[model samples]
Target chain A: MKRNKKMIIAFITPALVTFLVMFVYPVIRTVIMSFFKVESLTASTSEWQFAGLDNYIGIWKTPIFRTSMINMGVIWLVGGVIVLSVSLLLAVILTSGVRFKSFFRAAIYLPNVISAVALAIMWIQYVFSKKYGMLTSFFRALGLDNLAKISWLDSDMKFWAMLIAFCFGAVGYYMLIFLSGIEQIPQDLFEAATIDGANKMGQFAHITLPLLKGVFKTNLTFWSINTMMFFVWSKMFSPVETEASTISPVVYMYNIVFGTKGVTQRDAGRGAAIGVTMALFVLIIFFIFNRVLKDDDLEY
Target chain B: MKKKVISAVLCTTMAVAMLAGCGSNGGAKSNSTSKATSAASSAAESTSAKSKSTEPAKAEGGKNLVYWSMWNETEPQAEVIKDAIEEYQTESGNTVTVEWKGRDISTIIQAALDAGETIDLFDEDYQRVGQQYASKCMDLEDMAKAADYETHSVEALPTALRGWAGSLKGIAYQPYTSGIFYNKAMFKEAGIEKEPATWTEFLDACKKLKDAGYAPLVQDDAYVLYSYGFQIARHLGQDGVVDLCKNGGWAESEGALAAAKEIQSLVESGYYSEYAPDAYPNNENEIGYENAAMIVNASWVPSEITNNTKCDIEWGMFNYPTVDGGKDPATVANVGAQAFAIPDNSKNGQAAFDLIMKITTGAFDQKMALDTQSIPADPTNEEWPEMIAGCKDAFNALTNVYDWNMGLNTDADLKTVIQDNLMKLFEGKMTAEEFIAAVDAASK
Candidate 1:
């Protein structure tokens, strides 16, 4: 037992050290920093003193702060459901001995290989172009001359349509993750269900889904974290400057420090505060989700 | 015990990583300075004292020189700098490496100053760093005081050029000029006789184009909105946005609001679309050239816009139409390109300034203009490209130049107040009275 404990400590030490440095230290600094008024980052003689909860209040009072939460929520629910449903459907279809199963999986995972910036450029210039865009000319070739000038960006249904585009580009990769998870279930389970006179639908609901609960939970946590950070894309090309468009709270923090040409390049203290808040939000969501779902973890 | 030990380790790691950033940048600075000091005592001792050109001058005892500019020193303009870099290298056996950071020179300079980062030379487009001039970033007067200063600093460029550097706070690296452009083919098809000179003529021509099913003025709301203060100077009757900045006022005068109303008319006229001001960088405006008749763009606009769009449309620039009372009725100067000072902590000021002149006035100007259609900053380049060279007549007329948002000293507390609410003027969110009050409210 003593030897085993030593082995465990040795194995965990590297990861523990990395986590402390990468995650916990920032949170500690942020908690300490949340107590002060920010000044220019380079004030030599000036000091960052304690100010206790003021930064928190300042963030809470800002209208954009609340709106960011709503936007995150929207991305969460929408991305989660669509991702789950499509991924499960693909998983089911793939398990049925599809002719080009390997090829299909690779094709869907293509988006994962492309960089975000390249994907953004491809979508903006070729896919969603407004006046004289590539999509327009394509439509015109098909006899819809006026459609060549159609701008999806300026339409009243902007967010709705953009949501669909996001889903299409993103679903394939996550679906592959589900496909791998789905493939792991034993063949005997399905055979047993069929022998028991359970129809395909009944087997899918009773056996397939229950056994796949672990995979679903894993993907849920995985995607929730992914969607939470979707602001990375939102800041790059959304049309409006609403909290939904130009900034997420983290990106907003970036602008606060780096955007202006002033003496304050970045406020380390305030950045820490923002980081802590973000971590807290993510943790809260994780707990709330776990509590609501009871996170059924099953063993074979 | 596991949690405690884990927490301690986590805290230590976090402290180190964050400090790692502080360490790299800060350590670099200290390491350079100490090396520079050691070099200052003996030329032989200094060459190997530092590893990079982080110290102010004398990296390997002048084996290297660094020039930092707000943007890339690219072709059509970088040639002179490249030649000068060669000359500089041959003369001293020192290679001048140019750091071409695009945009955000102001913040870079400030950070350098704070860190005492040695910069050799720094310059940026005036509009981007104009706000820096409103505060003290660096002083040209002091540069003139430097022992290595040249005869070029003695006489200075032309007054307008000098003004480019002279908010009395920061110095301009070079002077820039502006002009107007129109589609020559569009005018001929519309059969509107000539380019408009007066406001009525301008409006009339616009109406005719509108009637002809063309957007009269293709103002890009996606880019920073371009409105010339000089042409409207005749109407404002005051010193324009400048005088207002000095005395803490915004002109509610008949002229200023009239300009706003004119723009509002264009917006309300269903002839306009804008990317959200902050968000337009990637939006539909990149595809702007195919739809609109005329654009209020500087010389660089043609290449930048047409780079992606291969439209073979004939375009031309003319003087911005003016009211009878405006200063220099043909003037269109509000924002134009100019270089700005580097932070005082520059390590290689000589090499940087040497590069600036080469890029701006030297042979690079000719090469850049010919290749890229970028207008020359020298104001005397007669060997011109046909389309761009022809712009001199229009370029010379710019005066009464002012943009509240363009200068370095923009009152920041009021910037959002002005920009957010002022955009509403284009959105027709306020009356002219409200517009003036809204913008002015920021300064106060």
Candidate 2:
């Protein structure tokens, strides 16, 4: 027993110390920073002025920040629905003894393997390009001149365009998760269902979905976290400056913290406050998910 | 017991390795600093030995200058700088160690400065160096006097730096001005005899170009705010525009309304191209493709267009034309420059300043301007690149330099709102009244 304990301690010390230094320390510092008026990120604690909830209150009053929050909310809710449904649908189709399943899976997941920056550029420069864009060419080919004329990168359509591109890349990962969940449910249960007069749709609705509640919850949690850190796509869409249509909470936080072109003031305190807000949002969503999707004691 | 002993040994090794890694980094930094010092001393001795008889005054060898540049190694600017550094080392017996931080220097520079990093010299946007790092920068007034920089360099730049930071904060290099960079071939094709000097003449020029079956003006979405800012600045100078942005007087400012009405008329008259507010580089490329005649952009646009598309555009530039009853004259322009600064914490400030002078003046300045297709910093170097030769008169004639977006970008909160509405105005989606009202409400 002594030997085992020694071995465990010896193996875990490095990881524990790293975790404390790298992750825990920064988290604690950021949390404390949220309550202080820190102009520069490198400003010493001695220079920090205790602003209490001022940063939080001030950020909420900022119109651009408010716009960013609204944009994030829309991306989360709308993007979540589209991504989950499409990924789930693809998961079902792929796992239903489909042809060349590996090839199809690889094809769908290829974008996820590519860098988000490169992927975003491909979408912006080619897919959503005003002139000679894929969608414009497609629409024109089909004699949809009105649709062809629509500028997908314009302020009105940019958000949706970004969302669609983001969701397209995200579906593959969630689809894999759903695929695993579907594969895990015993073949005997499905065979019995088929024998009982439960058709494919009925089987999916009753057995597959009910059993996949845990996976759905997991995917939802992941989606919520990803949406909270929604930065790259938004940044890529508005490369030069943060646009109202594409600005997210993280992007807003980055701008205020690191100082973008137009942002004269760099308040790391407000950036920390935004970080804390996002963390709270993710935590609340996690709590809600846990409560709503309670995993039952089901015999596999 | 054996497994535990092995694991204990492994853990101890890991901890020791981590500590050693950190120690090595510290050691490396210390080593570099000492190396620089030793190199300076050795060079001093050698110079004294070699030049003692011929030039006793030049016997004191050069100091090592640590320069953190904003350009990557592959960039044209960096190549020119590298050549200059080599020449400087050969001529003055100075050692310059340059770290190519690229654009990320702006973000990391403050932190590095705060950390008391041994950065002898650095360069960034003049406004950023002047305003953001004002207290940290060494006032170059005495150094400029010693070097006779006032007589050698462009007067407007140093004057602009003084205005920016209330002192001579930085030495300007690679200076550029934002104005109407136009296709001269298109101008000739449209029967335009001369560049427009006033708003009415500019509009007439636009009409003729449009009548000649060419798009008169096209602006990228990224530069729409800048374009609008130039128009606003023409009406209300840079300070007035900044005041309007800071305060909630946009709806009340007659200048703001006039500027908006001018842009509105441009949109209404089809003076702007069909893709006026297209994404960056797209609308700029329209000028390169000879589809558009003019774009209100920086003097670097021709070079950028040429580099990107390899299209030969007969580029000509003119300052933003004077608006009717405008406070600012046609002499005022939005001029910006890259500048070198010696940080207050720098140990070898004089050495850094000397290196900066070497890079930014005389033959090197002309060389940099030609190689990089940038405007020469040294006034004495009048052999401007043919691509941007037309900018010389406009640049030299500038009585005032405006801030980016005419200081409309001063307020972070209103920046996006103002830009969005400006785009809407150019796209004919919103009227001038709506723009003013919208921006005013947002400011409040």
Model 2 lDDT per residue over B1-444, tens place: 686677778889988886676551211111123344444565565543222111112224456678888898788888788877776565555667788888888888888777778889899888888777777789989777767788777788888789868999899999888789898988999999989999999999999999999999988778878888899989988889888888778878999999999999999999988877787777788887888899898888899999877998778999899989999998988878899999899877766777788789877888999998999998888899999999988898888788777888888778889877877888788999999999999999
Global local distance difference test of model 2 = 0.84
Error of 1 at A81 (Å): 2.9
- Which TM-score value belongs to model 1? 0.72
Runs in model 2 with CA error above 4 Å?
A: A4-11, A297-300, B1-5, B16-42, B45-65, B91-94
CAPRI band for model 1:
incorrect
lDDT of each: 0.54, 0.84
* Error in Å for residue B111 of model 1: 5.2
Worst 10 residues of 1 chain A by lDDT: A238-247
Going through the candidates in order, their DockQ values are 0.10, 0.54
TM-score of each: 0.72, 0.93
